[model samples]
Target: MKAAILDQAGKPLVIGEVDIAAPGPHEVLIRTAACGLCHSDLHFIDGAYPHAMPAIPGHEAAGVVISVGSEVRTVLPGDHVVTCLSAFCGHCEFCVTGRMALCLGGDTRRQKFGGARLTRGADKEVVNQMLNLSAFAEKMLVHEHACVSIDKDMPMDRAALLGCAVTTGAGAIFNACKLVPGETVAIIGCGGVGLAAINAARIAGAGQVIAVDPVPEKRELAKVLGATHVVDAMADDAAKQIIAISSGGVHHAIEAVGRQASADLAVAVLRRGGTATILGMMPLDCKVGLGAMDLLGGKKLQGAIMGMNHFPVDLPRLVDFYLRGLLDLDTLIAERITLDQINEGFDKMRAGTSARSVIIFDT
Candidate 1:
C-alpha cells in the first residue's frame, strides 16, 4: 500500500509503499477511497501535535469495506463507509453512558506486543497508524468501531469530510452546544469545519450566523455556506462587530482556528450564559479558559472531542443530509489531488488558501 509517511515532526511527509496487515479480531479492512487533508494533519506534520514517528497521518476518510474480522459484524465486504478517529470501546464507562466520542478506545488498538498494523521497506519497521484510521494510505486496517457504513449513494469525496471536519463542525452545533433554532452563533475560522458549522447553523435556523476569519475569500465562502454576517478575524474590533451584528453577544461561539487568540475571541464574544466549544487541536501545552467576568456571567468554555459525536448515529445522518441537498458538500471541497501530490496538498493547507483538499485514491 502507498502511504504518506511522516518520518518526524517539522518535516515533509514521505510518500512511499508500505505494508498493511490483515484485520484483527475486532478490526475491518478498507480499500481507501478518498481522504481529506485537514489542518489537524498539518499540526502533526508541523510538530504542533505529537505522534509516533514513521506513521501514516490521515483521519477524515471514506472507503469501501474489503473484508472484516471474524468478530466484526457492523460492516461487510462491499459496504461503503466513512472512517472516524474516535473509535470507541462499547462497554467503556463513557460509551455505556452515551458519550462514545469521549471513550478512550484504549482497547480498540492491538496491544503493543501484538505486532503492528503497518510496516515499511525491507526492514519492515513498524509504521504507526495515526488516530487509528491512518487513511492516508491505499488501505486502512482499523478497529470496526472507527468506521460506520454510509449510504452507497453518497459520493466518497464528500463522505470523507463527514469523518472529521463536517462531523466535528456540525456536531458542535447540533450536539455539543444544543443550539436552539433562534440562537445566534459565531464560528471563529472559515475553514472546512467552520463552514460546516455555518451550514449547520443555517439548517438549525440560527437567528444570526456570524462567520469570522481573516481571509476575505473564506469569509465570502462562509456567506455562501449560510453565514448571515461576516467579520474579519484580524480586525481590532472583530468581537465588537460580531456583538453588534447579533444585537448582543452570540449564544454560541465556536473556536475552530485552534489559536490562543481565536479561543479568546470565542470566549469574549459569548452572550451571558452562552457556551464556547473549542474544536481545534491546539498545541499540547496551550491553555484555554474563561476569566472571572465570564464565569460571573455564566459563560461556559469547554472542549468537545470529535464534537462529542456518536459516529454510529451521526455519520449516516450526515450522509443523508448531503444526499438530500440540505448539506452543501460541493461548496465545502476546494479541490482533489492524487496520493502522490499529498505533500503539495499540505503545502496549500499551510498557505491557508484552499478549503478542504481531498486525496482520491485509485481503486
Candidate 2:
C-alpha cells in the first residue's frame, strides 16, 4: 500500500509503500476512501507535539470495510465506515463511566512484544501508526471500536471530516457544553473545526453565534455557516467586541485555533457563570487559566478530548444530519488530492487559506 510516511519531526512526509498485516481477533481492515488533512497532524509534523518517528500521520478518514477479524461483528465487508483516533476499550473505567472518548484503548493495538501492523515493504522495518488509525495510507488496519458504520449515501470525502473536525466541534457543543436553545456562543477560529463548531451552534439553536478570527475570509465563511456575528481576532479590542455583541459576554465560548491567545479570548468573553471549552491542541508547555476574580464570578475553563465524543452513537447521528442537509460538510471540504500530493495539501493547510484538503484513494 502507498502511504505518506513521517520519518522525523520538522520534516516533510515521504511517500512510500508499506506492508500491512491482516486483522487480529478484534480488528478490521478498511480500504481507504478519503482522509481529511487536519491541524492535529500539522502539530506533529511541525514538532509541536512529540511522537515516535517513522510513523504515518492522519486520522480523519472514511472508508469501506474490506474484511474483519473473527470476533468483529459490528461491521462486515461492504459496510461504509468513518475512523476515529479515539479508539476505546469497552471495559475501561472511562468507558464504563459513559466517557468512552477518554478510554486509553490499550487493548486495541497489537502488543509491542508482538510484530507491528505496518512495515517498510523494502526493509521490513516496523513503522509506527499515528493515533492508531493512520489514515494517510491506501488502507488502514484498526480496532473495530475505532470505526462506526454510516449511511452508504454519505460522501466519503465529507464523512472523513466527521471522524475528527466535525465530531470534535459538534461534540464540544452537544457533549461538553450541552448548549441549550436561545443561548449565546462565541467561537474563536473559523477553519475546518471552527466552521463546524459554528454550524453545530446554529443547529443547537444558539440565539447568538459570534465567530472570531483574524482572517476576513474565514469570518465571511463563518457567517455563511451560521455565525450571527464575526469578530476579528487581530483587532485591538476583539474580546471587547465579543462581549458587546453578546450583550455583556456570551453564555459559552469555544476556542478552536489551539493558541494561548485564542483560549484567552474564549475566557475573556464569557458571561457570568458561563463556561469556556478549549478544543485546540495547545503546546504541551503552554498553560492557560483565569484569575481569582474570574473564577469567583462563576466563570469556568476546561479542556475537551476529541470533543468528549461517544463515537458509536454520535457518528451515526452526524451522518443523518448531513443526509438531512442540516450539516454543511460540502463547504468544509476545500480541495481533494491524491496520496502523492499529500505534502502539497499540508502546505495549503499551513497557509491557512483552505478549510480542508482531502486525500481520495483511487479504489
lDDT of 1 by residue, 1-363 (tens): 888899989988888899988788888999999999999999889988888888899999999999999899899999999999999999989999999999989999987775899998799899988998888999999998999998899999999999999999999998899999999999999999999999999998999999999999999999999998999999999989998998879999999989999998999899899999999988777898989998999999989988899889998998889888899999989999999999898999989966999999998
Worst 10 residues of 1 by lDDT: 107-116
User: lDDT (CA) for every model shown?
Assistant: 0.92, 0.93
Predicted candidate 2, C-alpha RMSD: 0.9
**Candidate 2 per-residue lDDT over residues 229-319, each given as its tens digit:** 9989999999989998889999899999999899988999998999999999998887899889898999999888899999999999999
- All predictions: root-mean-square deviation over Cα? 1.0, 0.9
Q: Candidate 1: global Cα-lDDT?
A: 0.92
Model 2 stretches astray by more than 4 angstroms: none
Off-target runs (Cα >4 Å) in candidate 1 are: none
Which pairs of residues clash in candidate 2, taking residues 3 or more apart in a chain or in different chains? none
